[model samples]
Target: MTVLRGRGVSLSAATEGGERAVSIDVEAYYRRYGPQVLRRCRFLLRDEEKAVDAMHDVFVQLLRYQGALKDAAPSSLLHRIATTVCLNRLRGAKRRPEDREDELVLQIASADDTESRTAARGLLDRLFGRVPASSQDIAVLHLVDGMTLEETAREVGLSVSGVRKRLRALTAVLQELELEAA
Candidate 1:
């Protein structure tokens, strides 16, 4: 008997004329790679809920290209697919209302510090309102969310170097604002 694999690879009877073929356990593959895929997606997406969506999208794409995944390097392949999914979602998304709500929540949450927190909140609100929307998102992702430059790049579809340049520009603006206030 002969069998055709999903990737179009074939296997025939193991005889003098046939070579033995190795089989992959798909369940094991999923178990082994699932956490890593989620982590990568989370790093790229920033938001926990959106990251879960991205992870699901990555798995769906992987299932669609099962044969290719079998042949390709899983980590790199998954990373590329996950990054693409995250970028697409980000590009399609508008400025979320939850972001503003979250910022307010953070401000309220920080009120435990009273006076200094009030000053910081005022400063941040003024500064953030002055920046472009995309720049503000990048800044919040990096500074408040504690994402690395590479992670911010993946989320915002910028190169790490480009993110660095933008961060520097933002920092300079913040310094000037601070000096003026002083």
Candidate 2:
């Protein structure tokens, strides 16, 4: 979404001669792009409270880096921020799963699936070990989160073909690993 031009608070910048003002239309940006950012948070978080919190966190990051972030692609920037915020929350949850593990266990635990779990763990290590985490993020955005290749490229700051090549290489690795497993 485009950051609409309008009245906003100005920040002081230290220049060669003196301090100057850098004005950012933050309200206009929030008005135009808040819904998209909130939707992305909700999709990734699946919790109303956390999603709202994450949305606010994304905007806070925007405000924090207002001077550096350009207006060329605000939508993609917000989307990327939302994804990162939610992903960080998810990782944090892993650090302390006991708070919610009671119900989660009932839903996802399988007593007889040790072999499957081991196999899946091996597959994950092999797939993720050789690649950068950005590649894994791309895979999640495109394959898990259902983002388009163009969207994924924008979020990851890569070309569409670069994202595709990463995915292709990942797929090839998976295929080879599958054959080895077989």
Candidate 3:
């Protein structure tokens, strides 16, 4: 008999010679990767509590897919999973009441005039709209999250040189937008 266990589910199957137990210890995996996963979620979500929740959600997903992902790279796989989970959350999200107040306060404090802030925001929106989602994700991981190029590349499944090239292209787009505005 072969006994398999994962995520509180267990099964026993017939084997030719002897009994074997294959168990996936999800707690161990969570302990190993929880912090890293949380960081990835925070980078994507920009909220600490939401990041923690997303990290837990990623672990739950790992439980569901652990069998198939046995041979996968843990960090990259978890990062990708966290990214997908965060993106999904963002997709159907509505602005929270407290967040609106916080945004208003931040905008008032940071901007000398409302017009420039609005212009800058519009420019940023246009720039982001022009970029591919993957490149945006890479930029956020490296730039916003302060991840190293190689680390971002690993998480994004890209070569370091490819990430660098995309960053350069992003910079060019910014420059073009600035010149057009001027």
Candidate 4:
């Protein structure tokens, strides 16, 4: 019996001296990794439906590239593929700036109490509106989504240092806004 390097499965040699590779159980693989892949894709794509499509595409790509993944860690491979798939989906698509603004507004509108929620929404709207569009996007991707600076850079097609600078600028603007509001 010979075991595949990273797949954690063993296969027996055939009578004719050929090693028969075990068939991939795609469903089991999906079941194990589906949620993780979906979460990563959703973080990158932001749209639930687009994230689902990207998840499916990632799985398909994984199946097609199974041979190459024989020696790679499955989780790392899945994350890398999911990130690439999401970035590809984002590349050709035109995102509506208003949609993102509305989404952020809605998130701010959902706080615990009605009065606080309204105040938060109003503050966020004013602050975000005053900031440059690029800064708003970076702020949302980094602060709201809890994405790392590297992930934000990947999503926004910015360098890590560029993202860091943008985030710092945004923070300064937010601080000024908070002081003015107070």
Candidate 5:
């Protein structure tokens, strides 16, 4: 919710992990990003308490991955992480076998535009059905959250070309699905 407001300059420490694990100023980051992350959670989980919990969980994940963290785009990275955390929670809530045909991926909550949100809500399941699950993540980040290709690549830990290929594959599958739908 909060972190992806824009590109963030890196603020890390060179000290080894201890009581201070991440180099970044943690309190400042929470103050800067916590609102947006909470906003994101509320939008997705549709529960105030759950949203708060998930937002905190996002920061915890950031702490967990601080060692390998390279990109300065904390907002984008945190947004992706927040989405992932909430989706996992949603998925876990319904622990039955994945009813892929009927289940909507809750990450599409980022499709904030009214028309696009409605449009995306229905197509997303079909889109995921026809392509790799990772592509589904790419589509949500790029197409739904409106992150640029490079930003999406960094967030998803893929090369831009690799992201492009998966997106292209998604387009092909979408075309086939559209033709079938028609």
Candidate 6:
């Protein structure tokens, strides 16, 4: 087997469909996107340990989808994968007795105004819950995390205009919700 270096990882290239193809370099992926993934997990889970675990889980998942991921944009795809992983973990926590304690702790430790934070998180959950998963990722990356529009677009694999349009529509809906609440 021949070894190929990709950002400090060794990957063996293989032939598929009579074309030379490269495998996913887990280490390279980690080196490039690990901190960002960790941040996403931490932002959602609000627990240092769980965030680390979630980041690891996402990489493990990347291994399973390595072939398909070879053609993907690493950052955008990883961001989406991290979001899905964190969301799944959150959902799973709700169903597990042991994890429930951790969830409660995370909720409480997330902010001083626990009630307002919970309400805001709930509102976001409901708002993004009604949209496509990509939209949720965009909202979290842009509005919640305060990433610029260009950054959010690049991370989400959308054109700037496309992301702008989505944000505008999302803002309108949120404004309507605010009006109704008021």
Best by TM-score: 6
Global lDDT of each candidate: 0.68, 0.73, 0.72, 0.71, 0.73, 0.74
TM-score of 5: 0.42
Q: Give the least accurate 10-residue stretch of model 5, judged by summed lDDT.
A: 96-105
Tens digit of lDDT per residue, candidate 6, span 55-97? 9999999888886666457888888899999999898766432
Tens digit per residue, CA lDDT, model 2, 78-113: 898889999999997775332242332233234358
Question: Which candidate, 1 or 6, has the higher TM-score?
Answer: 6
Query: After aligning candidate 4 to the native by TM-score, how far in Å is the CA of 19 from where it should be?
Result: 6.2
Model 4: clashing residue pairs?
A: none
List residue ranges in candidate 3 displaced over 4 A.
Answer: 1-23, 94-182
Cα lDDT for residue 89, candidate 1: 78
Q: Give the C-alpha miss distance for residue 30 in model 6, angstroms.
A: 0.9
* All candidates: CA RMSD (Å): 11.4, 13.6, 13.0, 10.8, 15.4, 14.5
How close is every model to the real structure, measured as TM-score? Answer: 0.39, 0.45, 0.41, 0.42, 0.42, 0.47
Per-residue alpha-carbon lDDT of model 5 for 1-182, expressed as tens digits? Answer: 11222233344443444433234544567888889889998999999988999999998887777766754677887788889999998997575222222223343565778897888767767777888888889877876666877898999999988887887787777667768879
lDDT by residue (tens digit), candidate 4, 50-90? 89999999889977866545533667878998999998767
lDDT of 2: 0.73
lDDT of 3 at 123: 64
* Greater-lDDT candidate between 2 and 3: 2
Task: Give the per-residue Cα lDDT of candidate 1 at 53.
Answer: 79
Which one wins on lDDT?
A: 6
Summarize candidate 1's per-residue lDDT along 3-108 as a digit string, tens digits. Answer: 5455322323345556544344345556667688788878877888878878888877866766444544667777788889888877754422223334543664
